[model samples]
Target: MSPQQKALILPEKQGNFKVGSRSIPSPGIGQLLVKVHSAALNPVDYKIQDDGIFVTHYPAVLGVDIAGIVEELGEGVENFRKGDKVLAHGNPSIIDQGAFQQYSLTVATSTAKIPSSQSFDSAATVPQGLDTAIAGLYGKHLGAGIAPPWAKTASDLEPKYPIVILGGSSSVGSYTIQLARLSGFYPIITTASPNNEDLVKDYGATHFFDRHLSGRQLMAAISEVTDSPIRIVYDAISLPETQSVGWGLLAQNGILVLTLPPSVKEDEGKGRKAVSTIGSPHVPYDEEIFRSSWAMIEKWLSEGTIQPNNYEILPNGLEGIIGGLERMRMEQVSGTKLVAHPQETK
Candidate 1:
């Protein structure tokens, strides 16, 4: 029999998660077998368990943010070696590659070495949130089609533009604010609860407004800050209300990027557009851009160009994830990622 490992598994569509056993998978070409140290929870995890979206197989393992040590490397994987600490964006739909397991396989190109400045729990919070922000801001098909800061001639561009990110305290929103700053968007405006004002500003938001404000009120407040047109609006919390706010704030010919389906209707005459962003690098539309971005993640984290989100470690290892996900569904978690130490599971 192959070696076995502990995993949190969903037995069926919309099924409850439970501790289970699965065989440790081998590293295939361009892959690394990682011993998962920390796995971070996201809103999508509970959504998958509740709505059964984006996953088809039974007895599936679900998680996207992973940080761990490489146990072995597959053929053609040259950049990483045994025992290298790394962080990766896991594809939860694939059982062998999911983050909710003690061991899983990770795609080499999408994995980056975790810098000494970050712990496994902190690094685990970055993969999914950062990828979503990247796809929403820089992807041609999935986002606003803006030039990424990593592009060769991006630094030569001179025109400064304005951007608005709804839900600035969210993981995705925070990363979007930081990347927008790197892209040279001036007066980076964001909306969040007043308690998170300092947090979002630290992430590079040039202007902040209370998220509870009405769309008209938000627009009025933003007007007081910048005369430049709002060409891009990223609704990290794409609830119907937030979507409406983002759409209302967008300029003609501007794009409104949404993490969920857009609730606002687009008027053809106005030339405003709404785009739903997919954060997975496994998807073809975002694969290339993610590959390029992944190459720079290590340097970015090490240099403090990108800061990982605030995280709280969960108790009882894998079992604690259930309560954490419940808290997320109940809207109890705020401004922090919940990380579980899988290896600590009993």
Candidate 2:
């Protein structure tokens, strides 16, 4: 194996990305060295480059989703072999584990083997998206405190409530819609542009609202569909406008989960709360919660309970990611993940 690999690096805070050589890190205990075949882009990747957030180190390599072949294994890892196909939640905080490189390292706790039915490009879209859904729906403190459907404690819920997921076409939102269905949430309502209504419904959203609808219009429209009070709203978009719509729709004591910082303040003394999700499994608080979800990912993907986001591969390998991030920043990307093959890096 080569001692060095190509990587796209942010030379400094808020700096442009440049392709350069980086050392291929050795796997640590309970870790696997992966030769990344596919790396998916996220909105946060652009945000990091533009706003210089998340990474506290210099020359950062920012990427979270990963799917590839396990080139080697570290000590005490028994579930996988050296040549297994795997999908993992790469820890972007550590440059060596970032997925923008050809070879990356992933802890066994957050890695899962890809089923034969799935491709590396498709699997690349799952890690961050699915983990965000799990964090928003099942995190004891961060989420609505619902039992994970896959867990033994899962019940039909004391009330079998309905849920509203804003921006259902997004990667995170698509997975949220599916997980909502798995949790037995009836009348799974979501908001997306008209073009993506079918896409959201395919992911199990029972009802879809045009994203352009006013808060009042959406509230009245949803009321016509179901009388159930909206007890939970996952605002995957979390823009100020979308957050306001979600906050207005929530019944008292409901939770509003956001992927971004809350721009809309919650009303005081309404018993309604708004919280944000940190999707990385490497976070100390999220370790146990994320590990529990990661254990079921392979089965979920294999059985078709969880569908990957529709993805479009970018041209030019790792170099292609530069243009891809620009498109995402401009909001030109919709309804599909942008995937890049690091092996094609030049």
Candidate 3:
């Protein structure tokens, strides 16, 4: 590999990212130097690009999801080795920054072994959204069959039962559907634009309601699917319209899990609850909760339980980051992930 590698660089806030080369750093303690094969773009990527609130250093990288092979392991790192395939979400809180680079360094706990059946692009797409799903759907009880990384016991029963996933057509919603199915939840219901009803159905949604449909009609559709009340709910896109509709759909004694902020009262009737299902290590930008999700998803991906959704590969490596971000900003990229590839300089 070449001593210098190219990465997408955001020179400043509201700036267009350009391609530039930098020296690839060697592994540090408990870190791995990965030769990134691909980096998946998320809605947050465009948000960060627009605001640049998290850019501590100039010419910073801005991708979050990464898939690659471990090029070198830092001292005392035993779980991986040179050339071992892996996938990880580069935690933004750490000084390490992002993955829109050829070589990225990340903590071992934040990565997982990628399944052989999945491509680097697909593997890159799974970690962040899947982690969100694990957090939103299973929460603390992820170990009980659909156990997320934080589960300490496998005997825990479903909490705030009868969870519903709002925006089931999203990447996070896809995983929530799969995990809910694996967790033995009956009658998983979801809301999407009417066009995506068939796609949501393919993801194992027992019932599909259109977000554009009237509130009365949506409620009637949901009611026909389940005899029990809806308890736990995860809203991927926590916009006011989605949450307002989702909250009204929640049954008595229900708990709402929102990726964004909630619009309902803190407590519902009959011991019901509503809270944003945020990951742990919440203080001052710690992502310890994400670490747990990464590990648990590794096992699930390997077992073929979860699958990555539609994606479009972007060529020209990090140079293409701007174009990809532009497409997402305009909401042109829908139901498909924009992934940038960064190969080793041979």
Q: By lDDT, who's the top model here?
A: 1
Tell me the TM-score of each prediction against the true structure: 0.98, 0.98, 0.87
Which sections of candidate 2 miss by over 4 Å? 154-156
Global lDDT of model 3: 0.73
Stretches of candidate 3 exceeding 4 Å from the true structure: 54-57, 93-97, 140-154, 158-161, 263-273, 278-292, 344-346
RMSD of 1: 1.3
Q: What overall lDDT goes with each candidate model?
A: 0.93, 0.91, 0.73
What is the C-alpha lDDT profile of model 3 across 1-346, one tens digit per residue? 7888887777777687777878887878888999899899887777777877645666677777889999889998998888989988685544343788888987787778887788898898886777677666555432112344245465755552455788888888888888787776778888888888888888788888876776678778777777677766777778777777677777765666777656766555456556665432222332545555666766777777787877898867777767888887786865677888877322
Worst 10 residues of 3 by lDDT: 141-150
Task: Name every residue pair that clashes in candidate 1.
Answer: none
